[model samples]
Target: MWYEILPSAGIILTFMTIPGFAMYGLNKLVLGNGYRRNMDLRFNRMMYQRDMRLTGDPYKQNGLNAVDG
Candidate 1:
């Protein structure tokens, strides 16, 4: 009876552990990619805003003159 229970217990433990590890790995992968994508989006948006500021004529018409002013 003890020997039979040992096999069943091992199977149960294996099933539980394997899925837990798989889910952890998948979670890490998704989060890392999402972070990278977000950073890229932020960078692109900043660049676009900078370009718009540099090329726009409103500041010239308003006589702001300086890029930082």
Candidate 2:
């Protein structure tokens, strides 16, 4: 009896999880690369600002304070 129930339980779980997994899988397949690139650029810019702050140099190469004397 217990062995018979295991097969039904697997089918029920498949019904529950398969649709959700499919949706996320398709979403990642479609949008994952563009989203990753956008996030990478944002992270790099954040790190650049943080490093400049830690170094006490508020002037980037293009900073207003770095303008010609």
Candidate 3:
């Protein structure tokens, strides 16, 4: 019983880790890109903020078009 449960637990843990790893890679990419281009961290942050604001509203923004399935 314990041996069977261990495999399931490992699989569950792997699923959680995959997302976490992907997010870490994405964060590194965004910051890394700005760094290589000589842009300051503040500038990078501002750009991300602007994009979020532009896409935040489900009605006024592109949120609806983004989820067409």
Best by TM-score: 3
Query: Which 10-residue window of candidate 3 scores lowest in summed lDDT?
Result: 31-40
Residue pair clashes in candidate 2: none
lDDT of 2 by residue, 5-56 (tens): 9999999999999987787677568755222222358877786666456554
Per-residue lDDT tens digits of candidate 1, residues 1-52? 5687998899999998997677667756865421222235877767555655
Mark the 10 consecutive residues where model 2 has the least summed lDDT. 31-40
In order, the Cα lDDT scores of the candidates are 0.58, 0.61, 0.60
lDDT tens string, model 3, 1-69? 668899889999999899777866775687542122323688876755665566753123354565436
| TM-score for each candidate, following the candidate numbering | 0.40, 0.37, 0.41
In lDDT terms, how accurate is model 1? Answer: 0.58
Which residue pairs clash in candidate 3? none
Candidate 1 has what TM-score?
Answer: 0.40
Candidate 3's TM-score reads 0.41
